[model samples]
Target: MKLRSLLFVPGDRPERFPKAVATGADALILDLEDSVVPERKPEARAAVRAWIEAPREDGPAVFVRVNPIDSDEVAADLEALAGLSLDGVVLPKAEGAESVAMLLDRLPGDYLVLPVASETPAAVFQLGTFAGVAGRLAGVTWGAEDLPASIGAATAREDDGSYTDPYRVVRALTLFGAHAAGVPAIETVFPDFRNLDALAAYAARGQRDGFTGMLAIHPTQVSVINDAFTPSEAEIAHAKAVIAAFDANPGAGALQLDGKMIDAPHLKSARRLLALVG
Candidate 1:
C-alpha cells in the first residue's frame, strides 16, 4: 500500500500485464473504462479478471477501473466482478459523496474506492464529500477532457498546452478536498507520453503543491513519476535535521537552524516528509 505511483495498463493487453507489474510502481490499474471500447468491454473485463486470478511474481496492489455506475456497461461489469479479490474500483465521473455511497452499496465492503471528480460540473462542486464514504477511499483525481466538455469550454488545455484556468481551479479544489477527507490527493496523468521532460516537470509541480502522488498513462512514465514524488537523499537529511533540532529543544517554541527560524509547523512538515520516505 506504499503507493507513490499508480500505472495504468489497457485491460485487453494481457501480454503487458506482467510488464506493468515489473515497472516498480506502487499499484497497477487495469483500465476497463476509457481504454476499452464498447466492442471490447467484455474481453477487457475478462482479461482483467483472469490476470487477477492468476499468480503473479510482482505483488503491486491491483486495481481495476470499472465503467461508471450510470453507464449501461456497469451492471455487467459489477456482476462479473461481484466478489473478486480486487484492491479497489476507480469510479469515473463520480457525481458526489452520495454517488460514491450508492456505488459502495453495490460493491462489497472490502473493496477500496477511488473516484475521478472531473467528469461533470456537479461532481466538481461535491469533491468535499468523497471522504465521508466508508472503506478505503484511495484518493480523488480529475479528468481534463470531461470537465471542459461539461462546462462547454472549447478546450481543457490552453494554447501553451497547460490546463485552462477553470481546470486549474478544479485541481486545487480536488487537492483540498482530498486532504480534508484524510486521503491522498492524486494528480491526474499527462497524456503525452512522448514528452518525458514535460511530464517530469508537471509531476514535480504536483509534488510541490502537496499532492501525494500521480497516475501514469504509460508504463515508461512510472519511473519519472515515482522519482518526482519520492523524497531525495538531501530532502530526507534535511527533514531529519529539522526533526532533531526541534526534539533537542523541546522547551523552546522557536529556534534558529541553519540560519533559518525553526518552528513547530516546520518540524511537522519535516516529520511528514520522513514518514513518506519511510
Candidate 2:
C-alpha cells in the first residue's frame, strides 16, 4: 500500500473514524494507546472492532496502534483485533525483534507490522536488530515524545523546532535501520498540523532524506504530506529519461543527461522512483 500519508485517529472517538478515512490518507492508524484514557479502553476497542468489520467499498488501509506490549491492556487489544480484516497494528514502545515477534505470535493472519522502533532509551541500541524480522514490517518509525520523557530531557527539539542532536541521531538510526530492513523509512508526526508552510518544509526534508512517507496527526495535513512524498512531473520525467538513457546504452558505466554526469547510482535511484510510482 502507498503510505505517503498515514493519519492517526483516536480509537475512542468512533465518530471521527469515517471522517479520517475520507480525508484521503493513504492509511489510517486507529490509536488505542495514548489517545484513549484507561476508562475508555473497552469502548475504544469495540469501536475499532466495529469499524473494521463494517461494510465498506474503497478506503484507506486500517492499522490499530495497540497499547504498549508490556501493558495490561495489550491482551484486550489483541482480542479485539481477532478475526478482523485490517491492514496491521502499529506497535508502540517497541524494543526489538522480540517485541515484533511477540505481537506476530498472537496475530493469526499475515498482518504487516509497523513498529515505532525508538521510544525508550534501550530501544535506541536495538534498532539494528529489527533486520531480523524485516519480512513482516510495513515500515519502521520512531517517537520523539516518549524518549525525551524517558530520559528526562526538557525537549526533543531545539529553539527552531528542529530535533535536538540526540533525537537527530535517533532519527538517522531509524531511517538507516528501515532501509537495512528493506522497508519504507516512515518519518514521524510533524505535530503542528495547522502550520502548512512549516509542515511542507518538514515533509520535503523527509522526502529529500529518503523517507518514503510521514505520519500525520491531523486530516488537514494529509494532502501536504502526500504532495511532499510524491514525485513531481519534472521528477518523473527525469526518472524516465534516466531509465531510457541507461537502456539505450547497454553496459555503459557513465552517461551524460542534460549535461550532467549520471552513473550507476543514478540509474538505481531512477529505477527506484519508477518502481515506487508504478
Candidate 3:
C-alpha cells in the first residue's frame, strides 16, 4: 500500500469515520488507545468493530490502534476485532519482537502490524530488534508524547515544538531501525495541527530523511502529509531520465546526466523514487 499518510480517528466517534476516510489519507486508524477514555474503551471497541464490519467498496485501508500489550483492555480489543476485515493494527508502545510476536499470535488471520517502536525508555533500546519480526510488520513509527510522562520529564519537545536531544535520538533510532528491518520508516505526528506550514516542513524533512510516511492526529493534516511524500511529476520525469541514462550506458559504471556524474547509487535512488508512484 502507498502509505504516505495515516490519519487517526477516535474509535468512539463513528460519525467521524466517513469524514476521516474522505480526507484522502492512504489509511485510517480507528484509535482505541490514548484517544479513548478508560471508561469508554468497551464502547469504542464495539464502534470500531461495527465500522470495520460494515460494507464499503471505496476508501483508504483501515487499521486500528489497540491499547498497549500490557494493558488489561488489550485482550478485549483483540477479541472484538476477531473475524473483522482490517488492514492492520497500530501497536502503540510496542517494545520488541517478543511483544509483537505475542500480538500476532493472538490475531486471528494475516494482519499487517505497524509498531510504534519508541515510547518508553526501554523501548528506545529495543528498536534494533524489530528486524526479527519485519515480515509481519507494515512499517515502524515513533512518538514523543508518552515518553516524557513515563520518565517524569517536564516535556519531550523544546519550546519550538521540536524534539529535544533525547527525543531526537529516539526518532533517529526509529527511522534507522525501520530501514534496518526493511520496512518503511513512518514519522510520528506533529501535535500542533493548526500550524500547517510547520507541518509541511516537518513532512518534507521526513521524506528527505528517509521516512516513507507520517502519522496524522487531525484529518486536515492528511493532504499536506500526502503531498510531501508523493513525488511530483517533475521528479518522476527526472527519475525516468536517470534510469534511461543508466540503460543507455549498458555496462558503464558511471554516466553524465546534465553535466553531473551519475553512478550506481544515483541509479538506485532514482529507481526507488519511481517506485513510489507505482
Candidate 4:
C-alpha cells in the first residue's frame, strides 16, 4: 500500500466510510478499538465487514484496527472479520513479533499489519523483534496517547506541544525499529485538526526525520500530510541526478555532486526518496 497518509474513521460510524474514502487518503483505518464503545463494538465490527464485502471500485486501501492483541475482545474482533478482504490490521499495544504472529494466527489470510509498537512500557524494549515478522508488516507505527495513559503520565508531550524526552526516545526507537524491519516508519498523528499550519510543519518534520508516512485522525489532515511527504520538484530532480551519477560511475565509492562528496549512504537515501514517488 502507498501509505503516505492513513486516516482513521470510527467503525461505528458507517455513514462516514465513504466520506473518509473521498478524502483521498492512501488508506482508511476503520477503527474497532478505542473509537467504538464496548456496547457498540459488535455493531461496529458488523458495519466494517459490511462495507468491506460491498466492493467499492477505486476505494482507498482498507484496514481495520482490531482490539489490542492481549484483550479478550480481540477474539470477537477477529471472528467477526474472518475471511474478509482488507488491506491490513492495526494491532495496538504490540510488544514484539509474537504479538504480530498471534494476530496472524487468528486471521485467515496474509494481511498486512501496522503495529503500534510503543504503547505499553515493556513494548519500548521489544521493538527490535518486529524484524522477525517483517514479511507480514505493512509498516510499523507508535502511539503517544495510549502510552502516557498506560504509564499514568500527565502527558507524553511537554508544555511546548513537543514530545518529552522519554516519549521522544520511544518515537526514535519506533522509527529505527521500522527501518530495521525493512518497512516504512509511520509517524503518529497530530491530534489538533484545526491547526493546519502546525500540522504542515509537523508532517514536514516527520518526512525530514525519515518517517515515510504519518497517521491522520481527521480528514482535513490528509492533504497536509500528503503534501509534506510528497517529493518536491527540486527533490525529484536531485534524486534523479544522484541516480544518474551513480549509474555513470558503477562501483565508485565516492562521487562529487554539486561540490559535495556523495557516497553509499547518500545513494541509498536518494533511491529511497525516488521509490516513494514510483
**Which residue pairs clash within candidate 2?**
none
Clashing pairs in 4: none
Q: Which stretches of candidate 2 lie over 4 Å from their true place?
A: none
Clashing residue pairs, candidate 3?
none
Q: lDDT for each of the candidates?
A: 0.86, 0.93, 0.92, 0.94
Worst 10 residues of 2 by lDDT: 269-278
Tens digits of per-residue lDDT for model 2, 1-278? 88899999999999999899889999999999998999999999999999899899888989999998889999999999998999989999999888999999987788999999999998999898888999989999989999999989999998888999999999999999999988999999987778999999999999999999999999999999999999999999999999999999999999999999999999999998987797
For 163-198, candidate 3 gives per-residue lDDT tens digits of 899998999999999999989999999999999999
- What's the TM-score of every candidate structure? 0.96, 0.99, 0.98, 0.98
Per-residue lDDT of candidate 4, residues 1-278 (tens digit): 78999999999999999999999899999999999999999999999999999968887889999999889799999998899988899999999898999899989797999999999999999998899999999999999999999889999987778999999999999999999999999999998999999999999999999999999999999999999999999999998999999999999999999999999998999999999999
RMSD of each: 1.3, 0.7, 1.0, 0.9
lDDT of 3 at 266: 88
Q: How does candidate 3 score on lDDT?
A: 0.92
